[model samples]
Target: MTVHPDRLDELVRAARAGGVRGVGRRSFLRGASVSALAVGVPGLLAACGTESQVQTAESCTSEDRSAAEKALVFSNWPEYIDRKGKKMPTLEEFQTTSGISVTYNTDINDNTEFFGKVKDQLGGCEPIGRDIITMTDWMAARMVALGWVQELDMGAMPHVEANLKSDLRSPTWDPDRSYSVPWQSGLTGIAYNAKYTGEVGSFEELMTRSDLKGKVSLLSEMGDTMLFMLLLEGADPEDFTEEQWSGALGRLEGYVGSGQIRRFTGNDYIRDLNAGNVVACEAWSGDVIAMQYDNPDIKWVVPEEGLSLWSDNMLVPNKAEHKANAEALMDFYYQPEIAAQLAAWVNYICPVEGAQEAMEQVDPSLVDNPLIFPDEDFLANAYGFMELDESTRQQYDKDFARVIGA
Candidate 1:
């Protein structure tokens, strides 16, 4: 049964607050019975009560070959995966050997919208009908807290355990990766047109320089933009609080009122920077690489105050149908050779530790590119945004929407 859009948002907000698994026990049983009647699948309904009901990777052994044989339905953002001429060898090989059909879909257009669409089904006892999905770090953390995501069985993903970067291994959101795996990472920092603004040494310079009064832009994303602002304000990103958030918002609103911002943007900042309409703007590290490839004059800077180091993570929705196949796909991408090819195409920071060395063997130049492999010193100045509680998130969304919409 489909969920109403408005109710879905409420459920997500509730899930974020209550934790995905903390729904009242009686309510869970009721939802399961209702779902059984709606789907008319009694056997599936029988498996919907306690933690035992959820399928762990180990449970999908030779005994459950039939269920595991079904195709894995994977979903992610557009252009996030590797593909060449309609062929994905990494995926194709999994299909060839594992005898599991793969339906890779890019249906996630925005985080809040995706959360709204699937939150209800995931909150219920039965399967959410998706084996795997990718989402940004904060959203992934929310899903994990709600217990709407399954704890990955690392034993089934040996490649991931061996090859994933140690730094990415123990994120504050999901320490030890109990719920998610980083798909790729990058920094959110300043990107400026060299022709318009000689050289940007700091974020403050980019925002307040007299010459760039109305030509500066910042990201429209609440978490991304706020984290950068907090860093510039000298707040510790790892332990930011509501008071700090309020201060950052006040500073941002001041800049907005003063005509210091050209506009808050997403990918549009890329085009504007290229056209020289914007002298400086907030930019993703990977996007800067793309822009520089086209025009050498555009430069990305990890601000002196620091930058937000972010990642998009892969997670298994609670009670996914094809759990084994999904685990296999996760392992497939972690293989260094496969990961190298993906990094080459996407140009994001590879979370696979050895993927860069593997890529250098394939194409030597990628080894020294700072954007591809941010140096230790550069990483020293980067920080991950702390996860906010439900109340804080609402406050952030309200403040952010007003700033952007105004």
Candidate 2:
């Protein structure tokens, strides 16, 4: 639940020196190693079941015991919160102020893998024992569609209602954000080693520039990679038709066939880019930020095509006994001060709006770090991928997998 402060400082130093790197939040979505890439799509498909497991409040009733129990259980990704040894200073403050006993677990590695672990119970409208579970947009969308999560009392989480970034407030699947709240967000864009190449400008250049041929890499995740391809083909990624998807896929296939692409990658692209083996590639914001500390030549660019904006969200599953308590925790973190502390440590985009100003006190160095605290204009070019049904998603993932040599 917490990291030692000294350990945290050491991590910052090590990351700057390129001697250590924490896993990018979605790195596990593809594979831990390139050799294991083939299994990634299949794993995701297994989580996106064919049949709808939809439920209603009447069908799966839940009780709120926060009035008496004063306890909450939360599961999140590793090192996601600000910490000092076994104590989370911000969370400890919440427990003290609200009288809510908290149990936090960092057990989420891969979204689909975590889904597999809880699907049977969630499908049956049973409690998954977690009051709060953090998930990426697609997985959250799937769970919300399945009716496996509970609607939040938005009025009760006033901080979240007030501070959540406008860009993240309206995901297609939960347009009104009735069931999910973002924990953190980041961008997917162009990253290049300045030592090896001139500034790479856009997705179009990454795909067609002869100078970058056989030296560039793309992310292996379908949504992150294909979104850019869709943009290149003049298709809106948020509302593309099947024909548009095929066109994008065809363009990607052409690039691959021409040997213009080095390989599709997970976080392993960091290794190749650092060694100059990969001159330019599609990259995550957080990884590029860490790499820059060691290699100032490692540059991140908001592509001419646009950026892919995504988040890890928090949701309360159906039948969770501590719904109110979980809501309280969500609200607590949404407070700008607490949000800034978390952002200072995790270095992801803080989803709480006023956190940038609050960072003036928490860590002034990060106050202007665009990767961690981007303004609205900087985020204007960002887009989210279209939501899809299970069958369509499965087919698309399979198509992407085959082309990427997964």
**Candidate 1 structure quality by residue, lDDT tens digits, 1-406:** 9999999998889787775767677889999989878888766665895442223334422122326366788898765666777987677877887788989888876677788888766655446567889988988877776667777779989999998888788877788897788888888888889987788868788778889988988887777888877877779877877788779888888888888898887556778898889989888887777667679999988787887888999898866766677788888889888888877766788888788778877667887776668888878878887778666776778888887665
Computed on alpha carbons, the lDDT of every model, listed in order, comes to 0.78, 0.88
Q: How far does residue 196 in candidate 1 sit from its true spot (Å)?
A: 5.2
Judged by whole-model lDDT over C-alpha atoms, candidate 1 comes out at 0.78
Q: Which has the greatest TM-score?
A: 1
Cα-lDDT of candidate 2: 0.88
Off by over 4 Å in 2: 1-52, 63-71, 83-87, 99-101, 194-198, 208-216, 257-279, 294-297
Ten contiguous residues with the weakest lDDT in model 2: 23-32
lDDT of 1 at 347: 75
TM-score of each: 0.76, 0.76
Clashes of each: 3, 2
lDDT of 1 at 266: 58
Weakest 10 consecutive residues of candidate 1 by summed lDDT: 57-66
Clashing pairs in 1: 19-146, 20-146, 21-146
lDDT of 2 by residue, 288-366 (tens): 8767878999999999999999999999999899989998899999999999988887778999989999999998989
